[model samples]
Target: MWFSVAIRVGLAVLVNQKRYQEWTHDKLKRFLENGIMPNLYYAIDFTLDEAVLDVILIQGVVQCPKTMELYTGPTYIPNNVREMTLPGSPSGRARPIMLITTVMRYHLPSDLDWFHQPLTHYDYRKQRATSLAVAHPS
Candidate 1:
């Protein structure tokens, strides 16, 4: 069943040393408790030849209220290769990186009467700063 699969995946993530199991668990717990299911995305990086994979989860949502004639757009999953130079490489060598990603996005209905503006980029930055400030206040 899907629930079993989810539980297994969750357990695997929790046991994995590199994954942020505590953060993931807290986010999922808060979402369930608040009755707000924010959009979730996953970023997976893998090398087919080496059978290595790295996964990251991203949480996002369109707007606060869903009853306000909001539109839920189609989800997207994309895979691409990125090239980056080494930090201290004098030869200017570049490395190929595999980045497999998915995004969840919501679009507001065009007929909504209220102000309909996309969330600003700075909003996320501000939110992260605020979270850090609250967690470790000066």
Candidate 2:
């Protein structure tokens, strides 16, 4: 049997006049209307033996331990989008948090019986992190 774990990509956006939720909503609307996926890139480039299958969006409430403030917003999955609505923060101090989780198909050797590995243990982590700023700092 093969097993794979979903990878979560966290987006921390500061709230402004234009909320991040609007961007997500518009992006999803465009995908629904035209059936075109936006150009996607990993924060770091990587090659994978496994494949991502789908995505699910979630709006969850995260309560602060001290203030008990709640933060909630829509999240995303890979190829598919499902959403759950949760109430916003009472203090209205919770920033909208969007998390993208990639559903994946794993290819594990049948003889191995069990497998244990960290996502960062992969070869991609060894690759140097590069950016356009670094290329032309001037």
lDDT digits (tens) for residues 1-138 of candidate 1: 223333334334334433334556656433223221211212112121212122211111122122322112111111121211112232221221112111322232343211343433322222223333346667
Model 2 Cα lDDT, one tens digit per residue, 66-108: 3444434343322322222234432332322232222332343
TM-score of 2: 0.18
Q: Local error of candidate 2 at 59, Å?
A: 1.8
Error of 1 at 40 (Å): 21
For model 1, where is the 10-residue window of minimal lDDT? 70-79
Over 4 Å off, model 2: 1-58, 74-138
What TM-score goes with each of the models?
0.19, 0.18
TM-score top scorer: 1
* Every candidate's lDDT: 0.26, 0.28
